[model samples]
Target chain A: MINEEINEIQNIEIRLFLEALFQRYDYDFRNYSQAHIKRRILHRMNLNNFKNISEMQHRILYDPSFVQQILLDLSINVTEMYRDPSFYAAVRKEVIPILKTYPFIKTWHAGCSTGEEVYSMAILMREEGLLNRSQIYATDFNHKVLKIAKEGIYPIDQIKDYTTNYQKSGGKESFSSYYDANYNSVIIDSSLKKNIVFADHNLVTDSVFAEVNLIICRNVLIYFNRELQDKVIKLFLDSLAPGGILCLGSKENLQYSTHFEMFSVIDAHEKIYRKEYRH
Target chain B: MIEQKSFPIYKPLAIVIGTSAGGVEALTKIFIGLRAGFSIPILVVQHISPSSDSYLPKHLNRLTTVSVNEAIDKTSIEEFNAYLAPPNYHMLVEEDRTISLTVDEKVSYARPSIDVLFETASRAYGRNLLGVIMTGANADGASGSKLLREMGGFLVVQDPKSAHISTMPEAALQLAGADYVTNLEGIIEFLNQLK
Candidate 1:
């Protein structure tokens, strides 16, 4: 058979796998980026010796333990503290002042993978004395990562990179003050942890849990197709208070989004936008 | 000044080009063959500095009729345009003909990896894809070219003797024998003739 026919068949199989995953488990990855999902599925198939996607799908439907592996694989967890330091610096300069205007702040970190970004934002807010008045809701569909995020412990070696990023992002206090090193890992201080709440919320399947003032869902949206991206953006719009700020990953944009005109650009290069106060 | 026999007869729906080192100059030369009438979408993976701004697409736009763009995640690929994988991310093509960018670790010691682009393009486009390797300082495209040919796609290598740096084309040639071996002008002529 021709490769295109083979490719078409493989495509159908992948869709069935995703469909099976959604039907069997509650997680819905059907709307995720086709390229991203295919790459991750193929990687898992190669790793686990599944001859085809159907084999993987059968395992997914039958094996709860196997589904867990696929769930973790599908999640885009390659995040770090203060990723793209300039983004955080831009946030400090552009968004923080707007954040300062609010008397009582609530921020949502959607897809807060492993909670690095949640903690990173907490540190930024704490440095600015906003933590006392702030309540941060950090959510992800994967509870395994949420548990880790709630615990707030990361390997000690990553501290150097996080410190450098913090210093670059206009951090005022010593980066060391945020965490305590215990042998192999560093635990985030209670001061930084007090106002944050980590919970399981699927951007794909769940509705807004709270009306937030600043919604920071970075890099995560890039994993979804344009339709899903727009749907999630609309969700952010509905979830945010008027004039709330939305920050997306560097590679993502609103140009193709149907709801494009709702948010005016604050810093175009930083991918930061503020929702218009007008209804 | 070229024989009809020199060019491959197969028409490709898409073209995937990999280059580094002298990539900007090399791609500019290849793009000169692009007329407003040329329709196949050109997907490129150029080894740009990690910290560098994604200026190559804009820089190359001035010289070609094709709209050259830095690839944005989840964007659909269009014909008569060139998309360069943005800096610091690996670009892949989906079955639905959209582009996806990833930060999942670098392969072949490069992000915006040539191997990643070629491999994914091979899957998406199959035999209807044309894989081109030009002057570069690294061997990033070798295995990808091999897979491209194995999947029934055509491979074109810039003649190493004429290349600014031969490491890339030579690597591709050594691993995946070229369907056509030509210099800059020959490549341009070949591109100009594409339907």
Candidate 2:
């Protein structure tokens, strides 16, 4: 068959595969960016050594574990503490001051992934003296990763980079003081976890569950198609209290979002936007 | 932006460029040397530290007449512009010909893998995609260039001897020999002549 024919066939199979995922399980990834979903599908197919998406679909019918693996794979867990140092720095300089004015803070960290970012934010809040007055909902669709998040254990080797990021993000104290190295991994200070509630939240299907002063969704929006992105942004708009902050991934923006006018820029370079106080 | 159809006769709709170690200089040269108002959307993947700031576009935009900016997710492939992949993200071409990015595991030890972009661009643009491999220190783009060639897309390799670092161009030649192997000036001339 011709090359275009192959791509066409693979897409059809992928569509069926996504349908299978949504129907069999309640996970709806049908609206994800086709390119992102295609890459994930191809990656999984190569790993399983399946000749085609059809074979993958066939296995989906028989193996429950296979389904679980695929779902986990679909949820992007690629993140690190202080992934973008400047973003955290902006949070410290811009958002923290506003957060201080409020008596209490509520934060919804959508797609918390392995919890690196959630813990990173928790550390920031602790330093800013807002941890005790803050309630953070760190959530993801993947329960498996949520368990890892709750533990706050990361590789010791990775800690070095996180420390550098921490320092660059205007860290006030010794980074080593935040965690205890235990063998190959470092366990985060338990104090960071006290204000964070790790839970299950699927951005794809879930609605706004709370009113919050800050919403840090970050890179999670890029995985979605434009339509879904707008839908999710609406959910965020509804969830945020007026003048609340909504930070997104570096590449993601409200340029094409339907709800673009509803937010004002706090830090354009850092992708921090505040919901219009009156709106 | 001049239309690709205005090219009397042409084989490419998009140009994809990838490089590493010596990429900043090489890409700057290509962008500056190309005729003003070059209409093809040049998609570039240059290796840098994961936390590297958005310096490449700012640097290039000041030097080149072609508007250069970081590729945004779901952005369309418009004419007379260039898009560079963001640091620590894998930029792919969707079937709709828009850009899609991911933080998937690195390919060939590079987040914005040349192979990833080339392979996807070849699929999206088919024989109309022109894959360019220039000065670099890694073999990230070789396999992707090979796949691009397999999909009937064209390949352009910067002559290894002329490259500041020869490892990348030489690797591309060994794995996916280009339709045109030339120096920086020659590549620029070829692009300008596309009009």
Candidate 3:
């Protein structure tokens, strides 16, 4: 059918466009699943009202602004405060106890879109009386989301919902105590982010930059193919200190990865694993 | 010049879905109406605790005509059956066209993540896909559904009001801006009409 041919042509166009993007921009989506990459590119194309992928590629190649917009579309950066409240509850109950033994802590929240999870961890630390002794590194490939993460501002209306999640996550204090509500946004207390470093880092291209007592790279790796997943997990294994905790998104695990034996599940339901102390 | 085909036959081979918090009730309503002789494949990723042994397939299978089972790695994705992504792994369609499981980290705070399965299937099947975003708490499936829509695949979302948890559908509507928005009953009727 005519429609089927057009669909196939569109697929080819997206493939060519991504190839061009890597060749010129060096973003290296070459290893990502072809299906995911194509879908992302096509979404951008439609949003921009380009007739086809070729038009979107032409604009991306020539216009930096367009490329940035495409980057936002490509990153899949949707997140919310205490998005999975129970998961955080599990962290507070299971992981915090072990974290208390460490003299000082280094934590990493990889693919921390807009820093919600990072801030959530900061809140958890504050409650556990660990805030003063911890340093958190929050990283994402999308610079735009990273910028938002740094700002630490969120829609004021969402506070009600986030408060509910906060309570469900077993917050011991008033949720409103954490932020000052502005006209349309809530400015998170500056102190919560004091030890948090929001940075631009790509799991696809970047290497581990810190040795940490705990690494919480929740919900970021699913975008990649198996080979890429293996690569990222390896980075986490290398970065985690001996006996450090590695928390993953519930669906994520080290079981099938090359680093499977490097860590053992502490709370399998929570998807919390501990790096083996290889002495 | 080619003759235009009338009422382009939409023989839906598979149905893939992503949902968050309130997905269970919504899925039950939709599946209950799809009787045993239904010959389409259904794959679903509902956000659940990694430790929670989702007896979802078993529960839903009891209500629907179609066979339901939790997806296993390397299993062939077959028609007239439903596959639910297991609790802690991302489910993907391999190049060999079989179900491939990944221990990859969660995307969008979910394992058996909706985004992972939807995005991968969009790549594997292109327009030969039907992606649906149902009721849940977070925005997990929005971008993936958007991707499927762009790839010329059919897109559907549960009407936010009808969803037990509206966040997922609301977010999908805002981001992907779906092609069809309907209640669970309506979605069932739509699925029936797909053939």
* Predicted structure with the largest TM-score when compared to the true one: 2
| TM-score, chain B, each candidate | 0.94, 0.94, 0.92
Which model scores highest in lDDT? 2
Question: How should the candidates be ordered by TM-score, best one leading?
Answer: 2, 1, 3
Docking class of 1: medium
Q: For residues B1-195, could you state the per-residue lDDT of candidate 2 as single tens digits? A: 111222226747899999999899998888888887778888999998887888999999988778899999889988878999999999999888999888888999999899889988887888888888999988999998988877777788898999999999989988877788889998888888985
Backbone clashes in model 2, listed as residue pairs? none
Q: After superposition, how far is residue B131 of candidate 3 from its true place, in Å?
A: 10
List clashing residue pairs in candidate 3. A35-B123, A219-B106, A251-B88, A251-B111, B21-B137, B35-B65, B36-B65
Task: Give the TM-score comparing model 2 with the true structure, all chains together.
Answer: 0.95
Deviation of model 2 at A188, angstroms: 1.2
Better of 1 and 2 by DockQ: 2
Model 3, span A1-279: residue lDDT tens: 554567668767877887877777867676665545665676566776888888878877888777677676666666778866888999898899999998999999888988877888899899999999998989888888899999999999888888998899998899899999999999889999899988888888899799999988776665666678789888988899999998877655566688888888888867899999984
- lDDT by residue for model 3 (B51-160), tens: 56768889998998788888755566887788998877778875446676655447788777788788777766777788888888888988888777776677888889
The superposed Cα distance between candidate 3 and the true structure at residue B156, in angstroms, equals 15
Each model's RMSD to truth, in Å? 3.0, 3.4, 7.5
CA lDDT, every model vs. true structure: 0.87, 0.88, 0.79
Number of colliding residue pairs in each model: 0, 0, 7
Per residue, candidate 2 scores C-alpha lDDT tens digits across A160-274 of 8899999999999899988999999999999888888998988889988999999998889988888999999999999999999999998889888989999999998889999
